[model samples]
Target chain A: MEKKQSKLSIVTNGLLHENPNLRLVLGTCPTLAITTSVFNSIGMGLAATFVLIFSNMAISACRKIIPDKVRIPAFITIIAGFVTVVMMLVQAFVQPLYQALGVYLPLIVVNCIILGRAEMFASKNGVLDSALDGLGMGIGFTLTLTAMGFIRELLGAGTLFGIQILPDAVEPMAILASPPGGFFVFGVLMALAIMLDEKQGRKVDADPEKIGCAGCPNSKNCHGEGGCE
Target chain B: MLVKSSPHIRDNSSTQKIMLDVILALCPAILASAIIFGLRALLVIAVTVVSCVVFEYLYCRLMKKPNPIADLSAVVTGILLAFNLPSTLPLWMAVIGAFVSIVIAKQLFGGLGHNFANPAIVGRIVLAVSFAGRMTAYAYPEVTNGVAALAGATPLVATRNADLPLLTLFLGTHGGVLGETCAAALLLGGIWLVVRRVISPVIPVTYLATVAVISLLAGQEPLVQLLSGGLMLGAIFMATDYVTSPYTLTGKLVYGLGLGIITCAIRFWATSAEGVSYAILLMNLLVPYINDLTRQKPLGGGKRK
Candidate 1:
C-alpha cells in the first residue's frame, strides 16, 4: 500500500504539481511549435512520451554504472537512440503525422524534459519510480499541448482536429495558428496553471534556490560553496 | 484659510482630466469618420468603448483590485482601438480587441500606467494579424445621394504605382480604416491635444518630419505618405501615449526618429502598404531602453567610471 501510494504520488506530481511544460517550463520549443493543431500536439506528445518513458527507465537502470563526468553524454546517447526508434516507428506507421512533426521529431533527442527527468529524478531514483515520473510528466505535457492545441486550432483555424466547429459566419482568428498566437496561448496557459496551483495552496516553487542544486544537471560538476549562481 | 504644509503647489491635471482632454480631442476624427463612413462607424466605436470599459471593470473586480475605469484611460483606449479598425469589422471582433486591449494588454500588466506598449496599438495589431482579410478590407468613402458605398483599396494600397488626388487624400475621402480616412480631421484633433498641452508635440513633429524626409529621399511622394494611412493618427495619439512613450526630451526625439524609420522601412520595403501601427508597437517595446539611454544627468554629477 505504501509503495502504491508513493508511485501514485510520483505520477500525480508530474501531472500538475511539477508539470514539465506549465510548471517546470521544459521543452518549450515543441510546446510552441506543433501545438497549432490538435493532431500534431497529440502525435508529438505521444512520441515524446514514448521517448521519455524508455529514456527514464534506461537512465535510472544505468545510473550506478555511468560515471559522473560522462553521465550527460551517456544520457543523451540513450535518449537519441530511443528518439530515433520512435521517429522510425512514427515514419513507418503514421506518414502524415510524421510529416507534420517534421524536424521536431528528430529534435526530440535534445528535449529538455527527457534530459531534465534523467538528471533531476531518474539518476537518483529507482527505475520504476523514474518510469512513473516519465509517464506523469509525459501526460502533463500532453495535456498542456492538447489544451493549447484545442484553443489555437479552435480560435485560429475555427476547426478541431480538422473538423469545422465554428459556423461559416464566424471567421476564425488566423493569428492564433501563427507563431505569435502560439506564444500568447502558451503564456496565458502558464499563467493559468500557476494561478490554479497557487489557489490550491500548492506553493509554486518558482524560486531557483528552493529547487536548488538537485534540480540542476550540472550540480555534479559545480564546486560552488552554497549553490550555482 | 487653514494652515497648509510648506510645499503646497499641486497641478490640477489628474489622469481623469488628461484622459477627458484626449477624448475631446478625438472628437473631430470621430465626427469625420461618422460623416465619411456613416453610422456603422459610430456603432463600432460605441461597442468597442463599452466593451473595453466592461472588460476593465470585470478584470479589476475579479482580481479584487481597485476599479480603474473611473480614470477614463479605458475609454481612451477604446476610442483609439475603434479608430484603428475598419468600419466593416464585426462588432464581436471589436469586443475581442477591446478585451485584449483592456484585460490582456493593460490590466494584466498592472493596468493603465504599467502597460509596456500602447494598449490600443497592441489591440490593433492583434486584430490586424488575427482577421487579416476583414481588417484589410478598407471601405472607400463614397456617399452617393444619402447612401454610403464601399469600393476600392485604401490610398496606400492603391497609390503604389499611381498618385491619388492630393486634396482628396488631405480631406480623407479615400479608402482606409475608419479613423485614418480624414487627414484634416486627425490634424485638427492632434492640434487640439498639442494646444491643450495634454500631449507634447515633440514626438509627433519629430516623427512626421522623419517620415517626410525619408519619403523624400526614397523618391516617394512625401505629402501623400504623410497625409495617407494611420501616420497622423498614430504619431499624434498613440506614439505620444505617456505611459508607453519616453519621458525626457531627447528620449522622445529618439523614439520619434525610430518610429519614423521603422514606419518608412515597412512601407517602402515590406509587403504591407501601411506600417503605422506596427511601427508604433515595435518602437513602444524599445521605450525603456530609449529612456535609459537618454536619462538626464543632474548638475555637478560625477561622470560614470
Candidate 2:
C-alpha cells in the first residue's frame, strides 16, 4: 500500500487506517442493525471477521485459477460458504447471539466489506496478505461496532453492558437504541474518524459520499445502468 | 475579479438578523410558557439554550471550524426544543435534547442551512421516544402561579368530547406542554413573524386550514382542534422552518396539506395525544422531494413529468 509496506501494516490497516466500516464505509447494513448492544456488536464482529479471513484466503489462493469476468460470483460463493459455517457455529454455541443477530448473520454473506476486500485486496494480494487484511478489517469493524453499541447502550439505557453507569439523576434516552439513533451515532462516529485521520497526519477525504462511492467495484452497474435517472 | 455565486441580487437581511427576528417572534410563546408552566419553563429553556450553544461551540472548536454560534440559530433551536417539552422535564433531559438538536441534527448534516430537517423537531422527537413516560406526563396548570401542582391528563385526554371554554384554551390556562397550551400567544408570535416577513404565510395558513377542514369532515369541533393542541405552535414555527419546508408556493401548499392530514391522523387515530411534532418531522423528511416536484419551470419550457 505504500513505498515500505510490511505484513504488520497490512493487518493494522484494517484496524485503523482503512477500517472497513469507518474508512471504507462498507458492510453498513449489518453494522447499523446489530450494533445496538456491545455484546451483539462483538459477536457480529467476530463472526464477520472469521468469514472475511477464510473468504479472503480462499479467494486469494484461487485468484490465478478464477477468471476475471466471473470473479464477483466466485468470490461471493466463497464468502457465502464461510458465512454458513460461522452462522452454524454461532447457533450451536451462542444461541442468544444467534437470536440477537437473527437474519443479519446470514446476510453477512453479502456484506460489502467481505466481498469488497476479496475483489479489491485478496484477488491481487498473496494468501498471507489477504488473511492479514481480513483480520485487520475485522478488528476495525468490530471496534467500530462496539464503540457505537457502547455509546448507544449507554445513552439509550443509562447503562454500559447492562451495568449502571450514569447517575440516577440522568434519564436515559431510549431513542438511541432505535434506527434514527443508529444513523446519528454512525454520522457522529464518521466525523470523529475523519478528524482522527487528520490528527494522524493522514489525508482523509472531506467528502463522505466520495469516500463511500469512489472505490466501489460495482459502480458501473449502480442504479442498474441508468436506473431512476 | 468578482468571484460570485448565484443570487447576485441580495437583500440587507443576514442570517443573524433573520434569526433575531425569529427569536423576537418566539418571545410571546416563551412568555406564555413561563406564565402557564412557571419558573421551570424558563429553567428548561435556559438549560436547552445554553447546552445547544455550548455543544455547537465545542464541536466547531474541536473540529477546527470557524465558530458558528454567532448565527443565533442554536438559541432559536433551544427555544423551540424547550417549547416542545413538558415543563416538568428534567434539565438534564433538556440538555440531551439540545445536544441531539445541535450536535447531531444541525452540525452533523454540515450545519445551519445544510441541515436536512428542523433540528429542534428532531431533538423533540428523540426526547419523546427516549423518555416517553416523562415526556408524556402532563401537569395540571395552576390558577395561582401557572405551575402544575400535580400531574393530570390534558384536554386531549380529558374525554372524547372534552369541552373547555374557548377563552381558556385561547389563553392557554390549561394543562399541556410548555409552549403548546397557549394558542393566543402562539398566534401573536406567528403574526409578528409574518409581519416582519420572516416566514411565508403559505405553510402556516394552509397547514391550519387543512387541520380545520379535516376536523370538520371528521365530525370533530374545528375550533377545539385548532385551540386545544400543538397545531398552532407547529404550523407557525416548526413546520415553517426555512431549511425543512418547501421553497415554492405549490410545494408549501402540498407540504401544509400533508402536514394537516398527518397531524389529524395521529391525533385522532394514533395513540399519541398530540401529533404536531411527529407531523412536522415526517414532512421535514419529504421537503426535498416536494421541492423537486414543485420546482419552477424554465422561462420558455422545462422537462415534463
Candidate 3:
C-alpha cells in the first residue's frame, strides 16, 4: 500500500506541485510558441510526452552501465533517438498537426523538462518511477499548454477548436493571437498557478537551503563549496 | 507646533495638482478636437474618462489598496488615450482601451508613478494592433458648415502625393486622430505646460529638432513632417510624461533623439504611416537604462576605489 501511494504521489506531484511548464517553468519556448491553438498544443504535448516517457525509462535502465563522465551525452543520444521516432509517427498519422507544430516537434529533444528529469529523477530512480514521473510531467505540461491555447484562441480569435463561439458583432482582439498575447496569457496563467498553489495551503518548498549547495548537481564537482562566502 | 524631522520643506504641488495642470494644458487640443471631429469626440473622451476612473476604483477596491482616483491621473490617461484613437471608434472599444490603460498598464504595475510606460501609449498600441481597421479609420474634419464629412485618410497617408497647405494643418482642419489634427492647439497646450513649469521643454524641443533635422536630411519637407501625424501631440505631451521620461537633462535629450530616429525610420520605410505612439512606447522602455547612464554624481564625491 505504501509503495502504491508513493507511485501515485510521484505522478500527482507533476500535475500541480511540480508541473513541468508552470511550476518548474521548463520547455518555455514550446509553451509560448505552439500554444496559439488547442490542436497544436495537444499534438505537441503528446509528442513530447511520448519522447519523455521512453527517454526517462531508457535512461533509468542504463544509469548504472553509462559512465558518470559521459552521462549527459549518453542521455542526449537516447532522447534524440526517441524524439526521432515520435516525430516520424506524428508525421505519418497527423499530417496537419505535424505541419502546424513544424520545427517544434523535432525540437523536443532539447526540451529542458526531458533532460532535467533524465538527470534529476530518472538516472537514480527505478525505471517504473521514472516512467511515472514522465507521465505526470507530460500531463501537467499538456494541461497548461491547452489552458493557454484555450484562452488565446477564445479571446484572440473568438473561436474554440476553430468553431466561432462569440457573436459575429464581437470583434476579437487580434493581438491575443500574436506573440505579445501569448506572453500575457503565459504570465497570467503562471500567476494563477502560483495563487492556487498558495490557496491550497501547500508550500512551494523554495527553501534555499534545501535547493542550495547540497541539492546542486555540481555538488560533487565543486567539493560542495558552491563558491559562497 | 509639532516638531518633525529636521530641514523639513515641502512644495505645494501634489499629484492631483500636477495632473490638474496637465488637464488644463490639454484643454486647447480637446476643444480643437471637439470642433473638428464633432460632438462624438466629446462622447469618446467622456466614455474613456469615466471608464478609466471606474476601472481604477474597482481595481483598488478589489485589491484593498488605497483608492487613487482622487489623483486625477486616470483622467489624464483617459484624455490621452481618447486623443490617440479615431473619433469614430466604437464606445465599447473605447471602454476596452480604458480598462487596458487603467487596470492592465497602470494598476497592474503598482499604479501612477510606478508604471513603466505611459498608460495611454500602451492602451493605444494594444487597440491599434487588435483593431487595426477601426483604429486607422480617420474621419475628415467636419468644421465646414456643421455637417459630417466623408471618411478620409490621414494627412500622413497622403504626404507623399499631396502637398497639404501648412495653414490647414496648422488650423487643425484635416483627417486624423482626435487630438493630432491641430498643430496650433497642441503647441498652445505645450507652451502652457512649459510656462507652468509642469513639464520641462527639453524633451519636446529636442524631439522636434531631431525630427526636423532628420526630415531635412531625408529630403522630405521638414515642416510638413514635423506638423503631420501624431508627432506634434506625441512630442509635446506623451514624450514628456514625468514617470516614463528620464530625469537628467542629458538623459531626456537621448530619449528624445531615440524617439525621433525610430519615428522617422518607421514613417520612411515601414508600412505604417504614423509611428509616434510606437516610438514613444519603445523609448519609454529604455528610460531606466538612460537614467542609469546619465545619473549625476554627488557634489564633492570622488570615484569609488
Per-residue error (Å), model 2, residue B201: 1.4
Instruction: Spell out the clash pairs found in candidate 3.
Output: none
Error of 1 at A86 (Å): 0.9
Alpha-carbon runs more than 4 Å astray in model 2: A1-5, A67-70, A208-229, B1-10, B143-151, B159-161, B301-305
CA lDDT, every model vs. true structure = 0.89, 0.86, 0.89
How many backbone clashes does every candidate have? 0, 1, 0
Best by lDDT: 1
lDDT of 1 by residue, B1-305 (tens): 89788768878889999999999999999999998888999999999999999999999999999988899999999999999999999899999999889988888778978998899999999999988898987666765654322336677876785677799888887778888879898899888998899999999999999999999999999999999999999999889999999999999999999999999999999988889999999999999999888888888899743
Q: How well does each candidate superpose onto the true structure, as a TM-score?
A: 0.92, 0.90, 0.91
The digit string of per-residue lDDT tens for model 3 on B188-227 reads 9999999999999999999999999999999999999999
Instruction: Name the regions of candidate 3 deviating beyond 4 angstroms.
Output: A1-5, A202-229, B1-8, B143-151, B300-305
Top candidate, metric TM-score: 1
Tens-digit per-residue lDDT, A1-229, candidate 2 = 3353599988988876688887778999987888888999999999999999999999999999999999999988999899999999999999999999999999998999998888778887889989998999999999999999999988878887778999988877788889888988997787788778778987666763664443432332242333312
TM-score between predicted and true chain B, model 1:
0.95
Task: Sort every candidate by TM-score, greatest first.
Answer: 1, 3, 2
